[model samples]
Target chain A: NAGVTQTPKFRVLKTGQSMTLLCAQDMNHEYMYWYRQDPGMGLRLIHYSVGEGTTAKGEVPDGYNVSRLKKQNFLLGLESAAPSQTSVYFCASRRWREDTDTQYFGPGTRLTVL
Target chain B: LAKTTQPISMDSYEGQEVNITCSHNNIATNDYITWYQQFPSQGPRFIIQGYKTKVTNEVASLFIPADRKSSTLSLPRVSLSDTAVYYCLVGDPRITGGGNKLTFGTGTQLKVEL
Candidate 1:
C-alpha cells in the first residue's frame, strides 16, 4: 500500500501566486496533518484534520489553509504565496487507535517561492 | 503543549551504539514520547515511541524515565545509513482536539561515519 503520497514533488512559485498541495493516504487513517520543514528548523504543523470534513489550525497556520473533504485526501492551499513559504512540505497520517501513535509521512514536496 | 529539547548535533562511528536524549520538562500527564528519523530531502519516519519506562522496536528503543521529564532514543550498531536528523515529539493521542497535533523542535543531527 502507498501509505501516503504527495503530488508535485517539487514546484517553483512567484509572489502572490496561489497553489494547492494534494496529499493522499491509502491506509485509511483518521488523522492527517500538513507541516513545513525549514532548514535548521524542526517540522512545524500548518494545519490538521481529525477526520473527513473536519479541519483545524495548527501551530503555524497563518499563511496556509487546509481541507479534508475525503477520508483519504487532505489538501493544503496557499492563497498568496510569499518567499517565506519556501520550504519542504510534508503530509503525515495516522490511525485513531489509542494504543498506537505512529504517524506515516509522505516523501515531501519541495516548494520554492520566488 | 509540551516542548522538547535535544542536542543540535552528534557524531558517532559506524558499528557503535548511539543514544540521543530529549528533554520535555513540561510534558503533561498523558503525553507520550515519540521519535522520528529524517534523511536529506525526505520526510520524517517514525522510529519508536513510549509513555514510561522502555519500549523497543525493530529499528530502535525508546527509554522514558520514571519522572517522565526526559526520554532517550537508542540506536544499536549504527551504520552510514543511520545518519539523519532525529526528532523527539511529545503529545497525547487520545484527545480528539488539538492534543494529538505534534509540535517539533530543532532535532538532533546524527552523523554516523566509517
Candidate 2:
C-alpha cells in the first residue's frame, strides 16, 4: 500500500521556469500538506488543504501554490521557479483523531534550480 | 506558532535508549509537541507527539513537562536503522484552517553505532 507518493523523484529547472509536483495518497486522509527542506533550516510548510477543493498558505508559501482537486491528490505548482525555491519538496497527509494526529509523508521530490 | 530548538547531533550505541530533548521556551498553551524522523534524501516520518505529561506508541515515547517549556523524545533499544535526523515540531493545538501544517525545527541528527 503506497501510503503517500510523489511524482518525479528528482527534477532540475532553470530560473523562472514553471513546474508542478504531484502528491497522491491511498489512505483516504482529509489533510494534505506541501513543504520544502533546506540545509540547516529544517522543513517549512508551503501550502496545505483540509479537504478536497480547498487550500491555504503555510509558513513559507511565498513562491508556491497548491491545489486539491481530488480527495486523494494534492498538487504543488511553482509559477516562477527561483534559485531560492530550489529545495527538497515533501508531501504529507494526516489521519484525524482527537487531541492528537500523526502525519505520513512521501519520499519527497528534489528540485535543483540553476 | 511556537518555536523549537533541538541539538545539532547525537551519538549513541546500538541497543541504547536515546533521549533527544527539545526546548520551546515560548510555547503557548495551545501548542503540541511532535517529532519526526528523516533519513538522507527522504521526507520526515512521524515518530511521536504529545500535549503534556507522557505519551507512548509502538515506536517511541514523548514527554512534556507541566510548564511546556520543553519536551523529550525517547527511543528505546535503538538500532542502526534508527540512525537518522530527528525533527521536533511545535504545532498549534487548535490546528484550524486546515490539517496540522506542522512546523519543523532544525532537528537533531542521531547516529547509531555498532
Candidate 3:
C-alpha cells in the first residue's frame, strides 16, 4: 500500500490567494487529520474527519477548511492565504480500532505564503 | 487535552543509548502516551506507545510511570540515522467519540554524532 500520499509537495502563494491540498490514503482508515507545523514548533491540528462527510474543528482551525467527500480522501483548503499560514502541512490517518491509536502520516507539503 | 513538556534538544554519540523524556503533569486517566520521530523535510513516523508500565517495539521503547504523569522514549544503539526530532503526545484513544484530541508539542531534537 502507498499508505498516505499528498499532492503538490511544495507550493507558494501570495496573500489572499487560495489553494487546496489533497490527501489520499490507501489504508481505508476511518479517521483523517490535517495539521500544520511551523518553524521551531510542533504540529497543530487544523481539522479532522471521523469518517466520510464528517468534519470537526481542531486546536488551530482558523483560516482553514476541510472536506472528506470520499472515504479515502481528505482535502484542506486555504480560503485566503496569509503569511502566518506559511508552514509544512501534514496529513495523517488511522484505523477505527479501539486497541490502536497509531496514525500514519504523509510526507508533508511545504507551503510558503508571501 | 494534556500539554506535554520535553527538552528542546539533545546530543549523543553513535552507538550510545538515547533517552528522551516528556512530562505531562495534567494527563487524564484514559490518556495514552505515544512517540513519533521525524527526519528533516519529512512527516513524523510512529515510534512507540504505552498507557502504563512499558511497551517495546523494534524502533524504540516507551515507558510510562505509575502516575502516568511522565513518559520516556528510549532508543537503543543510536546512529546518525537516528538523529531527528522526537515528539511525545498524550491523548484519548477514541477518536470517534473525541473528548481529547491528540496534540503535539515542540519535540526534542536529537543530534547524533559519529
lDDT of candidates 1 onward, in order: 0.92, 0.89, 0.91
**TM-score: model 2 vs. ground truth:** 0.92
Question: Per-residue lDDT for B1-114 in model 3, tens only?
Answer: 898999999999999999999999999887888899999999999888788998998888888889999999999999999999999998888745672368888899999999
Best by TM-score: 1
Where model 1 places Cα greater than 4 Å from the true spot, the runs are none
Tell me the tens digit of each residue's lDDT in model 2 across A41-70: 788888999899999988888988889999
Q: Which TM-score values does chain B get in all models?
A: 0.97, 0.92, 0.95
- The two-chain DockQ for each candidate, comma-separated, is 0.78, 0.77, 0.70
Off by over 4 Å in 3: A96-98
Question: TM-score for all predictions?
Answer: 0.97, 0.92, 0.96
Ten contiguous residues minimizing lDDT sum, candidate 1 chain A:
A94-103
Clashing pairs in model 1?
none
Alpha-carbon DockQ of candidate 1: 0.78
C-alpha lDDT of residue A54 in model 2: 93
Q: Which digits, one per residue and each the tens of the lDDT, describe model 2 over residues B1-114?
A: 677888999999999999999999998887778898999988888888889999999999998988989999999999999999999988774666746666787789999999
- Give model 2's DockQ, 2 decimals: 0.77
| lDDT by residue for model 1 (B11-88), tens | 999999999999999999999888999999999898888889999989999888899999999999999999999999
* Candidate 3 - chain A - TM: 0.96
